[model samples]
Target: MLLGLAGNSCIGHILRCFRAKTHSSFTSPINSFQFSRSIYCATMASAAAGETRTEPVYFSDTYLFSFDKASVLKAEKLEGDSNDYAVVTDQTIMHPQGGGQPSDQGEITTSVDGTDVVFQVKQVSKAKDSQEIKHIGCFSSGSAELLPVGQTVKMTINEDMRRLHARLHSAGHLLDTALNRLNASDLIPSKGYHFADGPYVEYIGNVANEERDKLMASMNEVLSDLVKENIATQITVGDSGERIVSIAGLPCPCGGTHVKSTAEIGPMKVTRMKKNKKNMKMSYSLESS
Candidate 1:
């Protein structure tokens, strides 16, 4: 769950959503003013020394974008039981690990009128209700005063880390498609799956040992062939609609980010495959050189 503003009454509600959905959902009320357009005016008009405005669009839809040069309109301490950290920014490139995926890690460099003062950024998260993203990182305690609300800052992501995540995530899609092909009618689409830090993935269902083997072999064959992989991503609302993409003969609706091609995932191997009492589980990790 993403952190909330301290002393804010919404803490209980935010925590409940975190437990129930394993996804961040903000429900706090913002002033009638539109967050983006009013940032500058709000910052100057506030009597509170640290008060600032927030824009939700900064976090909700950005899959890949640069925040290295974006400004900081607000950096209030978020309310939450955990003290790990949270601060809203004008714009960010870091992807928060939510929706079963892990959050992005990186740094934010703060400057005062073009002169570098301090660099901050360690953890990033999506704020509750606001849809704006937050970064929790180390900074000079005194530096907070130096970089007031509304000051501009530059953000950069750890590209290598992001690439690794993208590779594992794309592999997950392949695994899902492979399961569909093997069972045809018996296996169901993902009821639970994750492509996080360990790069671990799980497909839930019931299947026999022999059936599991055939599914694994089929997946390996596709990886071995090194067939070109292409992904087309789009946003759609609700059921009654579908998105299709060709992967050999597999097509499915997915909204997550993926590598441009399967070749980028080079030589994948299924390290572990087994079935629980009622569900078949597949575990995979990158092959060692």
Candidate 2:
């Protein structure tokens, strides 16, 4: 739930596919323009907005990449996007939390009878079952009442924050690639902590302290090579329809948002390495590139 102001056209192609499936006694919502899904984004009656919409995935398309504007599908306060505030849009550019990456925070603004209604988004999250993106936050200023459904609003993401997040995320993958080059792929990549606050990429490998420094130096070298090469980041689907993000140097399946190329990540430094009974953690942060 959130405190509320805010909220695509690629919907036509999707609607056609759904119609074809209806005649075949099968319906699937997994084929949005972004990534393949096993289930369609669920839609429900928004009590405040007075309309229904399939799950939105505009954020996944790097091209539609602008978090500039959207129409409000639903809006309610004290029961909205987050605790006491939130808004649901027909489609959203705001990236919701997923893949261990934190949600994006931003602002939404719309005109009501010539008055600007502003909604400050504090959080954006994706629900597990339906995987819907919810823009949760508070009204910076404007009527506290539920924003009328079908209203149009402008969106503005915190650019610096988004960049920081993307860099951390790409850095994690770069390290994964480095590990593979070192033939330590047995590290069996595990979970990832990509947030700017203490970002790290964890792996299943646990080596003695003597082995840690050697591994760190190798990873830094990979980073150096990546910068010099300016390798481009590419996205594609796997045979199983999983979203995969790959670099010229490494291959891995990742749904997290990333920069356009290795250079965009600038330079990164390996700060620390730690071992636990269960997992080995690689802590890293950005260096002035």
Candidate 3:
């Protein structure tokens, strides 16, 4: 859908500025593709580590909560998703959804003497300019006027929610591993729906119902056994500059928070698998022990 402005080109730019699709009331694969791709591109091109830019703390420590103090840089009013404000900090521990994982939900607080001022982070994301990461939420005081630039804040993430997200995302990678183990690397991974409602990894291939059922059972068993094996999850930067997440030696391009080891993912289950015309959507879930 080519969205062009009839009166002025500036209007199109303004529309793009408010990237939230809430007002559009249109939901299509094409629109979703563009939105998710835009986030991916921003995540990839963001400020690199240790180069005089706000560092993505999750890149180094995903388990970190109550992260060290960070100076507030900018606060942009990002309307939509509850009239949230995009807070840019000198550094962040909240992981934005990228490369097929959901974003972290958390809060950041600043203290004065003994009094604490809090900011609830409803969503985390990177600005399209790739300059800084945005912790999108509203101030605890119900007004953005309280959050000012240069103020230092302490960050805290929702550990339980973050862990669940890690498990789900790791499950997605495990599913991809299962595909490769079956010599089905030809099923290129295109996108992923990692949120809790109905998470699945979309691949570019049509699979028969019978084959998908067998896959569900077999992959579930493998993931379960792998978790029992207690294989640690390792992360490293790729030659092409993508953050690679690997488990039991199988690697995948990912830029999202994850558990430290396969053991941390309590119990794995293959919940659903369905065909989307030409795409195969493999769904799964994690059971907490």
TM-score of each: 0.64, 0.76, 0.75
- Residue range 207-288, candidate 1, lDDT tens digits: 6766667766777776556434443322221122221222333333332334556666556766666665555556665543
CA RMSD per model (angstroms):
10.0, 9.5, 11.8
CA lDDT of each candidate? 0.47, 0.61, 0.63
lDDT of 2: 0.61
lDDT of 3 by residue, 87-111 (tens): 8887787877555556788888776
Worst 10 residues of 1 by lDDT: 3-12
Best-to-worst lDDT order: 3, 2, 1
**How far out, in Å, is residue 144 in model 3?**
4.7
Instruction: Indicate the residue-level lDDT of 195 in model 2.
Output: 73
Off by over 4 Å in 3: 1-53, 79-83, 113-115, 142-146
In terms of TM-score, the best-performing candidate is 2
Query: Over all chains combined, what TM-score does candidate 3 have?
Result: 0.75
lDDT of 2 at 259: 77
Candidates arranged by TM-score, highest first? 2, 3, 1
TM-score of 2: 0.76
